[model samples]
Target: MDLTMSCSSLSLLFFISLHIHFLVPGSGKFLPFRECAPFVCGDKNISYPFRHNERPTHCGYPGYELGCDGHNPTLVMESLTYRVIHMNTNMQILEVARKDLSDDLCHGAHVNTTLNSSLFNYTSSDLNSILFYDCDSSPIFGSYPFSCPTSGDSYFAPVVDLEHLPQELCNFSVLVPISQSDEAPDRPPPSEDSDFGAPINHAARISEILNKGFEITWIANTAQCENCTESGGICGYDWKRQRFNCFCTDGAYSPTCNGTRVPGSFPSRNKKMGLKVGIGMAALGAGIVVTLILMRALIKQRSVHFDGEMKIEGLVSSRRYTYKDIKRMTNSFEEKLGQGGYGCVYKGKLGDSQLVAVKILKKLKGDAEEFFNEVASISRTSHVNVVSLLGFCFEGSKRALVYEFMPNGSLEKFIFNRSNTLEVDRQLSWDTLYQISLGIAHGLEYLHRGCNTRILHFDIKPHNILLDANYCPKISDFGLAKICSRQESIVSMLGARGTPGYIAPELFMRNIGGVSHKSDVYSYGMMVLEMVGRRKNIEVAVDRTSETYFPHWVHRRLELRQELGLHGITNEEDEAIAKKMIVIGLWCIQIDPRARPCMTQVVEMLKGSVDTLQFPPKPLLSSPSRSLAACPCESSSLQEGNDSSWGYSISIIRDRLSL
Candidate 1:
């Protein structure tokens, strides 16, 4: 009898232990529903779908976890952390503001606020407010101008005025969503006779709108949660199964807890006890595997967050296309317009029947930064003389830039006697060439001073300039461009950049001077000389000793007051235009950076007559001794020591020309 009683006690204890284990959450068994009592998080009552991190996972919906920082509640969505200012459970809306903007609006990372569309969405009452940073001038439209001691001037305006925001005057911009109600309370109604709309207190108005925060409604399993709650069960989530779970006092159910048994719930007490133990063991093993998979996914998410790919997407205003879309638009890389070291350009048409040139870049390792730089630099520009960026494609290693198509193709074929029908048929006249030169000068001037941020195009050559249907020159190919603040006259660079023959002396030889906009001026000078002479600056000869540098040849002729003996100069007017171009090109190519004229001065000189312009000093050195045949058109990594070969004297040519 004693032995039998001991055996019965052991059996009871084993059954009780199994029951308790099944009652616990995440055991893949029946989870008992306990009252998920509401708690205060930073003065706001949090409950149901939104729960603090200290609570169990089943207490809240997935991706809705909140953390407390001091006296405020913080939430992170789409990798951007925000402070929760208010929560309305009934309306299923949350009001939150960016933590970075709240702390330091001036120095925060220049990124737009992005939310997970699957989990939350902005309310209809919200309006986009843009902040233009490092603006050189105020907006033409009504705006609230503010200044940061370290960052310079900035402007804030609504999305309605975005078209008139003056992108040329701002170095960076960020889009922020604000409630229209917030603005309505602070702003006075516009008067009929008012020139500048309503007067606003800059600090108070902006602060109130930002601090009050914007509203976004949560949509994660809302209907299911409501159904579960109405069925007398606590709303929860089955993270392992990735579905809604309804918990009651006895066990967890799929949709509700109205006497429905979960998959692994305990069988009736009369069923076999051994079957229950086997099911429990299998569920435990499956739980471990699911947990491991989730952990790996979490690690991958963190890696992507730090990679900065999302940041790049958020910063650019242009449209983004996938690799498949690129192939479809290009018709499997058909109709190649041109090819270069960086990539190949293909003619493609958009859905709207708009012609575009898709430049597909080569898949080179560690060129991601260059691709990003090109996108960032060119997207900020808006000028008649600059190529328009329509869209872009960035997928893994496949990258491409989509630009408005130029019917005349690159200026290279036209300037150089390339064997193309378009080049022969559309031969550029002297007047047309002069207009192209003036247009290029205007584009450079806009890059240097017209924009809030100065852009230095290290590679400025005819090959990079595209001509439109009307023969208008538009500066293209910003692959080697450097963006700097307007205040930064000189910029720091890791190494020399630009085509070999057109690279400024300061780039390869640091002792000459710091690299600045004047470096671009040097490149422009070489290109103009090439256009004037209708040949390369340095031409390869059968013997290196007899090689002729075009700039040296042109300067010699100009010094002797000789007629520019060249093709296409049929009249005195043509000769005058040629003389004016040669003089301006010479002034731009001065060895000393300070001696080189700025783009603004170059534009003014181009507009003026040849008689008013004085002769610029002769260049100190001719072309380097290196053979032009071996150098590629795009050589960006020329070292400083290589300058030794470029010390050839021009005295021999000068004396010969004087005689």
Candidate 2:
């Protein structure tokens, strides 16, 4: 039977060779299999990169080689190379074939292998070494000394941790060759009876198949090791973990192990010394970051900073200004433009004809940084529709801002005054009103989206809008503005941010959603309708003051066509402008934040056809109990005629108490 088996094996080998040769005619090109030599033979179909002749000198990195297992074509790389798993322009990853256990007897064969460090190179600077295994099932497979820092144990189960394994064992799975068996001269035929168990095949039997020191070539620019340098690291084999160990030296830290600091005076020169330094550096950096965060929190807690002059390094410089200079400039508060929550505003001349308005900022229950930030943020932005910052003064317990004078005064003066009602004669033409609308949209657009960071004008109302000599609108009073990331929508309020009547419904109900740039769009829309109507919808109609707010009132009228004066206003031009403004306003104040058009779209509408305008569904009007709050509008500035005739003196608009 032995003689017959040997003869059969020789004949079978011949038959396979003949069949393979017909497909690949060259024999001289075959590479011999030595300890580390490349194997190349079989079909021409497998050539260069995957060759049948001698493996090309540069076919792959040193470890990978093309070979034929007698009659079976194979690609070998170290201990694995199960199959080509992936190949892209940059690199390739292969599945490692598993090694099968043939014998149940432990210690059946002494298989010992060691990697010669000089034979192959490792391509990944991030990766250290390869991990191997020693299984009790296969006695022929010997224990290989790996290069990791930690000793490893038997890991021959089906699912292996790939990340923990070295590059060579990456995707490979091992199985015993079926061709090798103990019966019939140890050469098994392909038939099921002779080919079946792993008992016939063993990794140790095919010594010719084993490779040593496979060199992994540099991936060129393919893999980026942004932080690694070759010098001062111990690049030696670590049998414990079966991977290369790179111990960094010389008071350094980081993945590249390149960051260096001065070493302490005691030079123990011990390898363990670097570990102590690494811990100290990490602790120090953490402490610094923590301290900064705590400092900011403390500042906010101490709200009295707003009452005194704050000397911050980067924010502002401390200085003094005589109150006399302010009195002279304002002519002792003679030309009072308006009065509000902040303080009274007076039109003054700084230099010859350099008209400026001075506003004394209100004292607030907050950190000085909040007040300063408001001034700094607005001062930096320069837009045609935004009020320009003129120099300011910060005296002890007193802070005042100076801005370029808007000669035509506030939008409320021209639009809603019961006495100085020239608005009918100085009617806002459709074109001029449209231009003003575009100007206001442009300013809000800048605040919402154009800056490096988004700013929300929490107090957007007609009084805060000032008209210049040209009737172009400029937004003012940024004291209540919120500075934040555009992505941040809702803000945790110490109190409500906007006025009662104009505030969006979402602002009051925190459960509804967060407030974003869209919230400001809603306020600006309410202001637009106020400007067009030139009437304070809430308090104007004596009886309705207890019923509807401006925005809701506008919606109700439009729904009934009483909005546009459907037949038309007695004054055609004013009526048309009113209709257009009302439509644009509806588009702005949509209750669903997403439904409202952005400021950019608002500007486009003002310039486009009013007929193209789309009106949003009417928001339910808030009842008087929920909407009206003591008519926040204060008593009007008393004129000379009223004072003389009524025997009443002009009660000065008291600072905080008036608004």
Which one is best on TM-score?
Answer: 1
Query: How close is every model to the real structure, measured as TM-score?
Result: 0.51, 0.46
Q: What's every prediction's RMSD, in angstroms?
A: 21.0, 30.8
Encode model 2's per-residue lDDT on 318-388: one tens digit a residue: 22245677777788878877777666788888757789888866655444444565576675577898888
Task: Please write out the lDDT profile of model 1 over residues 53-114, one tens digit for every residue.
Answer: 88778777888888889677899986778999888877888889988777777766698877
Predictions in order: lDDT: 0.71, 0.48
Winner by lDDT: 1
Worst 10 residues of 1 by lDDT: 630-639
Q: What is the lDDT of candidate 1?
A: 0.71
Backbone atom clashes (below 3 Å) for every candidate = 0, 29
